[model samples]
Target: MASGFNQKNKQCSLQELAALVPDGSSIALGGSFLHRGPFAFVRELIRQEKRGLELIKQSPGYDVDILCRAGVLRRVRAGIVAMEGNFGLAPWYRRAVERREIELEEHACASLTAGLRAAAFGVPFQPCGGLHGSSLPELNGWKCLDDPYGSGQKTWVVPAIRPDFAVIQASEVDAQGNVRVHGTAHWDRIMSRAAGSVLVVAEKVVDSAVFEAQPESTLVPYFMVQNYAVVAGGAWPGSSWPAYAIDYPAVEAYMDKNSDLRAHMAAAPEAQEGNHG
Candidate 1:
């Protein structure tokens, strides 16, 4: 559980980040839709022409669509995959899955979070009794088998998801990589702790003292942060909230223009640039 930013901060690049990720590696990502995505880092991945990464997003948006369009991702485990709306309907993802261009393991949003929580807490598995009598079981590929405990209701078991790495974006971070997620945190902390390694992209790096003075504001401690870089406008063309403004017109343009997932992915900037990290 080593903390703090890597010693070679300035020396690190998105290419180095790509080295930590491998083909078909399962990745848990931060943000909900376009909210807090590690856009610059992800763009760097696309720029590097990285490929074959597997992504697990609870609520994906352009980040997932862009990667898929770049052909950098091969598989996805997600609750919802779309680029439209704030946290719903990733048209690009839906198109890709429907066209059989990628493999998808879908689950309910709450179940996805619960499973991630179990992994972060070091649990072997999470019994999803909460999904009983819901459409989630069918969507997740779980059969309506008899309950062993005879609870009189079917139970779906969601396996723990311990991702190889979790990539996130935040409003601020100290030089040591202690992240503070302002406003809605979504599941940034859960993804950070559950993954084997964590990479964060911050808008700015403040003094370590600033973090220490207000420890409660720290959402993810440096202890869990493996690699961190200061990336301004990292979540640009999306929403970064108080740190920056959302590119509403851009988002709207993306939604209005693309009818299918592949087309949307094809339209992603990263796809043309050829990076996915």
Candidate 2:
């Protein structure tokens, strides 16, 4: 957890942020598909060589794939894992699952969101509809319950999915840890609330006055952030909209040369966000 709920000034280096998640943690990643991911923070986690971690995300692309390549993940709970059109698939993630090197517990997009909502709302479970005619409900151990008011309709109840941490990418976060995310927060609010703690990887760390002047822009409040790091272009090779777009060439090159990650990363400085606080 964070130092304290009331503790201010959560800014730290990427390494310090990564240190908070120990081995065997079940971590929820922010962003959807390839946009606005905490790639820089993910890189630090790999560099630190954290092992036996469980990844939880509704949709993941580069983050899950790289972790699979690094042998950092033991299990994954996600609805979809793939690189978009620029790249057809997350090859390393596919290979790992095919090789039975790790475990996967899949969910539909709605089901996963229900689970997060359950945890965030401090409920035992949340009722989910639209999962009919699918095996995922049974496969995921979601219980079936009859509608209470004698309506006789049945729904799936997803047990609370409380991850150890939620790591998010932000457009900006102030020294006090108030976060601002410009485009496509993409279930980040629910993910943050559902997790035990939150870590933010930000494009810039600004002054608290910036947030005070525009409180409505604060997507994540100060108390919710355990720690954060300032990394310009933190989401590289993936888009952090209004700032940059997906680096498809870099991504394709990564798929080809990932076996030599050190060499590949040397050519893409934004992948590691440089070694600065």
- Model 2 regions more than 4 Å off: 1-8, 257-259, 270-275
Q: Lowest lDDT 10-mer window, candidate 2?
A: 1-10
Cα lDDT for residue 35, model 1? 83
Over 207-242, each residue of candidate 1 has an lDDT whose tens digit, in order, gives 777877888888888767787766666786677878
Best by lDDT: 2
- The models' CA-based lDDT, in order, is 0.73, 0.86
For candidate 2, write residues 161-275 as lDDT tens digits: 9999999999988777888998779989999999999999898877777787888888889888889888887788788988899888778878884357876555554444455
Residue 86 in model 1: lDDT: 58
TM-scores for the candidates: 0.82, 0.94
